[model samples]
Target chain A: MKTVIIKYNAGNVSSVSFALERIGINALISENAEEIKSADKIIFPGVGEAGSAMNYLRQNKLDEVIHSLTQPILGICLGMQLMCNYSEEGKTNCLGIFDQNVKLFPLSELKVPQVGWNTITDLKTNLFSGIIENEYQYLVHSYYVELSAYTIAQTNYGISFSSALNKNNFYGVQFHPERSGAAGQKILENFIKL
Target chain B: MLSKRIISCLDIKDGRTVKGVNFENIIDAGDPVELAIAYAQQGIDELVFLDITASNEKRKILVDLVSRISRQVNIPFTVGGGISSVEDVSVLLNSGADKVSINSAAVKDPGLLKKMAGQFGSQCIVVAIDTKFENNDWWVYINGGQINTGIKAVDWAKKITELGAGEILLTSMNNDGTKKGFAVNITKQISEAVNIPVIASGGAGTMQHFKEIFISGKADAALAASIFHYKEIEVLELKKYLKNNNLEIRI
Candidate 1:
């Protein structure tokens, strides 16, 4: 199946393409509206600043393109953060897909970027089909989205936060499924089947 | 809960895994991709590939190696050695590396860190600091530990984080390949001084060495080469041991 990954001025876009390739699916990465709207699935992924990323999406009008897509869409990491109503990082507004807000991890003795494999529990969607609860997934983020009604998965680091968000046809995961091993692959594969 | 990471470091020379003492007297270990897959099956938390090769052509092969490993393994992959510019970082990341570690080139142009952080995001920029104890202070070394930059290791660690380094791969030259133990003093120095995660590399002889570094050094992660290269210590057993010691481990 053909998938279109919404491209922006962010890093790690290559990894998403490579991950799709490994799963035997060819993905087109583009910022063009027509390419994104016609795809079977649209994956919006970003690994850069929220303020500038929102600016890029707004300037290219990708923000509107993403909101109008009727097909399934997946937002990863900063892309997921951008789907929220707003973000404390860079004090920028987001696409408002999940009806939530993003905030920096509360100040504590813990490291800023939760950079490692951690267990995810309380799964609430088919995004984790065939995946056992408390299975570890790789994550690296300095900010987190508050637990919202759309939050399908939750993880704890100093405090519980939304690790995965699902609302209607749109799905967002704060962790990098491309970087996580078999468990992560399972989640992506499940998404493909969805 | 956050778990302390155990990183398997593969030193690459001509695309084959190699381990050297004090960056000399090197010996080949095995194929890079093969060993990488083996480590992943053994429950390795992360894998680091250091391109110790000097030639530009060899750097290309290193990139190729990174691409192959990224396709084969799903763990966090980091490569160091020869990333001098944002383009180099892009090539490696595009090739599937989650992070690119900067060493000599970063010291040569301190601005590279800031630029890379701005372009690729700080989480992907890993600053690898090679240090040696001298005159009651740790000094930064470059060029395979041959040239001393006189930049104190602790100060450089703090500076890189401020400049937008997401993590630090702190290697102690004095204890490297010695298997004595990690330079816990210097590790603790940098780990405490910086808010970002510090990966303790260098001497790792036994499971206790891993425990000591994580406990006393306050290191977020510990990396070892020959110990894992030769299968002298199994990664699963070590993780179990660390977990038994009341430390958080993925296993």
Candidate 2:
């Protein structure tokens, strides 16, 4: 199976590729629209500010290509944020794969960039197949998307939010499955089969 | 719920883990990669690789090694030591390290912290401060603790966050390797002063020490080496102890 990881100006491109290789699948990392459109699976991984990353996507015309892909696409971290209708990060618009708005965690007592392992409770999709309920997944980000019709899982970090979302062929996880160990490996395996 | 973290640190010499590989009489602490895998399975919150003597050439091999390890380990891993430039941090992060800790470089040129934080978001930049209590105050030390910067440790900790550091790795020179306990006074001081997470390092002996560091020290996480490296304490047991005490922990 041909797996292509979109290589925009985002972090975790190498991480996404390496994660796939660990699961016995060699994925191609490229910004080329053709490779992304032709792949059996497309992984969009980002750990960056949305404004600049969106600029790269629009300038390279990769945004249009991503919108046209029909294969199973997975977005991790900021990649998932950009798949939303809009984002508070840099006040940028996103791909509308999931009709939701991304906003910054409230200026509350909890820390920004909640970096560590958090449990993804209230599972609702096969993306978590072979993974136990309340299994911990690694996450690192400041902005978050609240629960919506597309949200398949939930997590509480100061406030309850959509830990993972699904809209037909497009799926997004706020957590880093690649960085999440055995349960994460299982999630990747399930995604590949999907 | 955001839980407290237990981080296991591995010190490397040249590209090898500083275990039996270098010392004939010492116990083979096992391969660093294998040890890291064990920690992940044991539910250690994070893993830190510190190449104490990392040189230019050694860093290249370390990047390649990190790529291999990250695929298997799957936990948030941080690489530190000899990271003096944006390129160094980029290479390490590109090799699959989630974060890169900068030490003396941040002291020599404070601008590096902003540059690193800008290039790769603040979440990836960890500023490690090696501090010692002297003259009734904790002062920052550089050049592996040989020279003191004379910068007050608490002042430096606050400055790091202002300069865009996402976390601070505070290591007390006096308590490091002593196995007594953490410098709760200093750790709590810095933890309270900074909004970002403070990882208390140095002088961790018992499970109670970890608990004290978490509660008294007010540290979001605690890092230790000899205890975990020598197999004196297990990550699971420590987490259990912290959990029994009603502390939120990942298991």
Candidate 3:
């Protein structure tokens, strides 16, 4: 099967590419509409601010192309946030694929950016096919999509929020599966099988 | 809940892994690529490679080393030492480093942080601050902890975050290689001061030190060198201990 990683001005693409390679898949990194649309599965991976990333997607018309992709598409980290309707970071207007708004973690006595690895629970989708319910997944996010009907998994950090979301062919994960251990790799493998 | 991260730092000089105290007393550890792969398998949350060599010849060797390590491991890696410009950051990231850390160059030119953040995005730019306790205050140091900037650590952290740095890797020079414990007070001060993630480095002698850094320092991640290099504390074992202590950790 063919996989393409939507490339824009963001970080973490190389790690994702290397992960796919480990699974015996040679994924293409491309921003071209034709190349991304032709792939059997597409992975959107990013690590950056919301507004600027959204701007790049819109500027290149990748935003519309991504929304229309019929094949399974997985969004990672900031990629997942941008797949939502809007973001509080830089007041970003995203692709509106998931019908949710990404909001910044409220300033409290606790830390703002929830970094490192965190366990995910209440998984209710095929994404957790072979994975345990409360297994750990790596995450580094400042803004999060609030829990909605589409949320498949939830993670707690000062407050519990959506860790995984699914809406038809589009799937979004707030954690970095490429960096998370075996459980994370399983999630990606499931997504690939889908 | 977020599990605290345990990271091992490897100082690379002439394509080999080296460890020391306060950037002195250097000792050979192993090959950089081999050590990185070993740590990844041990469940290290992240890995950092600091290119300690200053010669122009070693620069090429470091790039090749980064490429090799990126192909071997799936975890995030950050590279530092002698990063001066946006091109430097781009070259490293292109070679497979998830993030490029700026230290002496960033302090010399504060605008470099903002510029790099704009060009490559904040998540790819890490600002490493080495601090030493002086006159009852934490002062930022540069030149591999050889020169003190005379700037307060807290103030500099706030400024860098405002300038759009994604994360801060704070190293306590006085505590480095001492293995007593993390400079908890300094880490707590900086973690409270910035909105970004603070990685506490130095003074990590035992697994309990990791617990202390997470609980008392409130740091998002703890980075150590000697303990991990010497196999004193395995990353998986450390995470298990933290989980038992009521601290969230990925197992």
| Angstrom error at residue A118, model 1 | 1.4
DockQ of each: 0.66, 0.68, 0.53
Looking at model 1, how many pairs of residues clash? 0
Task: Give the per-residue lDDT digits (tens) of candidate 1, residues A23-135.
Answer: 88889989889989899888888788899999999999988998898888889999899999999988998898888989988646667777888888899878999988888
Candidate 1 error regions (>4 Å): B19-29
| Worst lDDT 10-window in candidate 2 chain A | A106-115
Cα lDDT listed for each candidate: 0.87, 0.87, 0.86
Model 2, clash count? 0
How much of the real interface does each model capture, measured as fnat?
A: 0.65, 0.57, 0.56
Error of 3 at B101 (Å): 1.9
Let me know the TM-score candidate 1 reaches against the reference structure: 0.94
Across residues A1-194, which tens digit of lDDT does each residue of candidate 3 receive?
Answer: 88999999887788888888878889999999999999999999988778889899989999989988999999999999989998998898899999999988886645656667788889887878978878888777778888999899999887889999999999999999987766777788888999
Model 1 lDDT per residue over B25-129, tens place: 223236777777777878999999888787887778888888888877778899988788888998898777898899998899989889998888888888999
- RMSD to true structure for each model, in Å: 3.2, 2.3, 3.4
Error of 1 at B66 (Å): 2.1
Residue range A84-147, candidate 2, lDDT tens digits: 9999988999888899999988645666778787888888778887788889888888889999
TM per prediction? 0.94, 0.95, 0.92
Binned by DockQ into CAPRI classes (incorrect, acceptable, medium, high), candidate 3 is: medium
